[model samples]
Target: MSSEHTPPPRQQPTFLTAVAALEAVVADLDDEGFGPALGLVGGLFGSADPSEAAAAGPRLAALLPDAPPFPRAHLAMVVGACVEQGADPVACSGPVLAGLRGALTGAQRLVEGWERTGGGPLPDPEQDDPAEAHERIADPAVLDAWHAHLAVVAWWTLHLWQRAAWAVYAHPAVRTEARGSGVTAALLGLIRRYRGEQHDLKGLAHLAGMLDDEPLLVLDRPTGTGYLLRMSGLSDTFQLHTLLADVLIGGGHLPGVPQDPQVVALARTEFLDGRRVIATGAFNLVAPDGSWLWNEGTPSDIPVVDGVRTLVLDPLPYERSWSAGRFIQEIPGDLRLERVLSPAEAARLLATTAPARSAQQAFGAGQA
Candidate 1:
């Protein structure tokens, strides 16, 4: 589980099968318009040529307002598939674009509204038994709403669109836009909301970090908030660790935190032959005040301390999408950094904690 910037390749979304599952809905619906609705939208998302998608785009957009509550979630996937396939932007730049933006926007709106009623965990499942937990969950209508929304593809798409090849749509070239309508903002807005819910916001930093060019939506300028560094062009753990370690040592400008953060390493420690040894591995930044920053989005927290927030940006697969700018506070949760130590720190730590058994090796005077 190295937090090294090893980005898996840029795989395209599974476009064809993504919406084919929705075909099941056609059989269950009663309204006559529903069948045609499924057909029109379905064909556009099918393995049609880009020209075909372009022609069909406007028709689908016009039909949406009266389309018998067509699943916006499904529509979003279909549209994303279209983008993945290189659909002409003109078809989307019209009302079709409006529909595309609204798909993710609707999820955003839903989550934001949920935020307003209150902000805290639902009833503790551990404290309550299975039956009692169910009662507590069902008691809050908000929980019901949340579960319902999550049962669909919208939330998953929101979480995983970064893996999509067509995420290039996050930025609009002049060729892809209308006179005033926003074309690329669905992906753009997604970047901005990176600070939101844990469920909805997962994998976002990875996306922002790996982007060759993620507009730095939230972390661009200096403010009272600390900077969220871009991972653009950075390749491996070695480079990332070197840059970040230097930042910590130099008292770099992460405002609202103590100056001169300490770099702590989580070396892979093990007992060997009645002696302790540590394999060179994870590293992190720690302030005197226990403020920590490691950008590794592991399921576990830093073993060192609580409330350690990390904003690691992994370099992109290639120069392409934009990296979002962010303040440390704007990042969603307490995350970890690349589980790596800089060479200098690693050497110092090994010397201090687990020096070689022989003096010659320790002093670098051993036989070649």
Candidate 2:
């Protein structure tokens, strides 16, 4: 008789299939268990597109045994090997995008459920330390693949939000509708909630130390939160408010505990409770801090309707509002930077923001 105990068949995952299987397992797990599992499993898909990751739900369910293994750098290396075998990262992105969308949606729902029932203290999965992740994930090619995959997801998240904002504001009729409605309060709520989620998701994604660019929604200046609010007050446009609300509630961006007092105060006071009106002929570049970037020779109400036309009057020479003025000056057209969101873009963006896949099946397995 053979004396040795037979080792179970090696769970040799291929690049084409690894990510999908892993994300499927992640989808099945509950909030408490998902974090740890994700650290172990997510690395398999560092360069996969969302759809492939999304599709692997069933396979992951079938493949992952209870008491799954700790993150093995070797699994990622399998992905690297496949790349060497001629797998194109860009071509593979379609499925990876689908997978990410599924993951994000599930994450968002988990947060909503927790909030609904007041789940006791939030859960944090221990991400592998950089040194550890690198040590375990020994192959440079594998690491590069992983970083590239994450970069695409992060970039898409920010780009989608920016594009969505532009789409809502570009419609004159849409802008006309919300100019004086109760939409300001609604818009405030949406912005507050989305920003809350972005705060968490962005940090989580950044923890890997792979992303090199700054977040599109910069909280420091008058542009990010301030600009959103100012426009919320000036337009009170319901379509815009609804668009933002859908992204926050439906988009799978991670949720973080909100920390900024100024942001909170402004959302509550200015957007939720402040005045809402449509400017008839006024065009002003307001800072994120709620200060006006005055055109050099014009008063705040001089009807500088054309943003680019007003650039020549920028107060950059005065250095009073250099950042805001410079931002305006950089625009190629006569339109204000804020005017970039057009209806066609909004329509295209709407399709992208649609829920890519449902979590109903994925969450069914429940903490395996």
Candidate 3:
């Protein structure tokens, strides 16, 4: 036995093995394991090159012609993977985007089917196991939720393609190796705008769903302050330490405060005099404007002109209503200011908030 046993057919390299595994997942797309299989494929080849995507594209495309609408949307995403991986933008973008649009149309059809059938409540993946939830898409509400989620995914893929196309022609912002291009910055702005529009739509949908609705007041906080104080109900926390980080501080897309100029000046005076900034009426109070005050030795009262409202920052420490210590205490021991998060990590936070809100609506229906 010690004589010349062929060394176990030399195991494939890790990258090769990964490629095989991803190809297998793509091959299995039509099977019962479609959900997990799609996820596996994404994990394996999401960042892989066009060559890798090309290897699996045939198998992925095999199922798409007859695939269900939701699954079809997933296939579109897989197609995006190939495009993102160094494909010729002009030749490929048109076909790829066309395919994605078709997927979106299919998704819309699925939603229509749900509405026609009067489908059931949305499934919570956290609350329900995969096996139980896999085949439960008959419900309209559930389908709507899925539609929203999928739309976000598909649009994100498109956004990425736009970025990749932009990168080809655009110059880098920094000459250093890891520097971002102007394309990336532009994409960020587009993403911010898209996210804001989506968020405002969701907020409107949520608000409309409420039984006793009140007027909406959008507030923007002043920028350039060393710190932002966030108040939701009686609790206050520094913006950096908030659960969603800077999102709560600077992620407003709606119009600003609409108070009279005279009222804003008076508010500024009260703010300067160290009056507590409290919500008197029903308002969607948001963060302050950047660079409005914070300089010139006095904090500017966030302007509330038209419908835009800015945060009123007090330059004087003794005159301020919120204490730094109080805000500091609200932060958890585990929270860190400077931490790099993977997409997966950042997504987990969003995963909780959206589902929780959905669950509230789902369960609250019985109470009514």
Candidate 4:
């Protein structure tokens, strides 16, 4: 006689069960794979009619993770389902939009915490003024907070771009609608704010670098000040400079040192003739003792020197400013025809230009 065999019984899929299923898919993939998955899910759900998909929102939402390693695909699916089910995109937009907004808010809290903790690394006793200690703490803290804020804002902006691209691809009319939503203006404003924040962060980093006894709190490596300078004066060039200006002009940070005369001369020249130098590509300035300050570059070069402060500036046509006016206007000086960097310098500059983080990382994956 043959033994009787029984199959496993089917179980109903609860919201939690659905969420876990989506989360499992997310967990199995690396950072780079997340975007493709999200796109696939969006496409699948987006293809369906709004009424049918909206009915699936609850089930899709249930399948989503409540916290880290957010199931971006499931999120797209939920939105798609909502759209399919005839839920108003505006209404369906709430949860996903709220999540993004909340992420931004959380980033704000991190910044505030960093600010409350006195911003950068510790302060040096030699450089610290007893009278201004409190103000110094608060100022740098605020600036640091702003830096974090800018990063999150940039992340959100990129995210919106990706989502909008997907939506517009599905319904081309959305592209035209988006253009008129004042989004361009809002992005411009954010970019302006980012530039201002970058400037302040550079100054703070410089101040931190100057404190010889205290180690600087670098958000990244090198333990020195970094500058992000934009340059747009002469047409046909785009110059963006990131310089690491240390406390001791020539040498790294060291104790009880006389100011380098050459460095001082360089600074003065840069301050006085930088604009002309950037515009015309040539400049000669006399130091206090009458020594000449000279740094030459053609239009095609990146102005970076190994031993000296690095200045990166690009120049484009004057008319290009209409689209990137904020970026252009913020440039410290006009673009010149001189080459700033040699082949070696150019190689070094390229090495420093790292790719930006993908959308997945910006949304908190891999973050502690």
Which number leads on lDDT?
1
Error of 1 at 230 (Å): 19
Question: What TM-score, computed on C-alpha atoms, does each candidate reach?
Answer: 0.33, 0.24, 0.27, 0.25
Where model 3 places Cα greater than 4 Å from the true spot, the runs are: 1-6, 13-75, 90-106, 109-368
lDDT of 3 by residue, 255-303 (tens): 2333333222332222224433332121212233222221111111234
Clashes of 1: 22
Give each prediction's root-mean-square deviation over alpha carbons. Answer: 19.7, 21.6, 18.2, 22.0
User: After TM-score superposition, what is the CA distance of residue 108 in candidate 4 from its true location, in Å?
Assistant: 11
Q: Could you give candidate 1's per-residue lDDT for residues 244-354 as a string of tens digits?
A: 434432344332222122111111111122332222222332222222323332212212122332332222222221121121212222112232444454343333222
Model 4, 105-206: lDDT tens digits are: 433443454466567633332454423433332345346544444333323233432342232122223222333554323333333233222112221111
Q: Which stretches of candidate 2 lie over 4 Å from their true place?
A: 1-87, 127-199, 202-313, 317-368
- List the candidate 4 regions with Cα displacement exceeding 4 Å: 4-50, 58-65, 69-85, 99-157, 164-368
Show the lowest summed lDDT stretch of 10 residues, model 4. 211-220
- By the TM-score metric, which is better: model 1 or model 2? 1
Worst lDDT window (10 residues) for model 3? 206-215
**Span of 10 residues, lowest total lDDT, candidate 2:** 327-336
On TM-score, the candidate that comes out on top is: 1
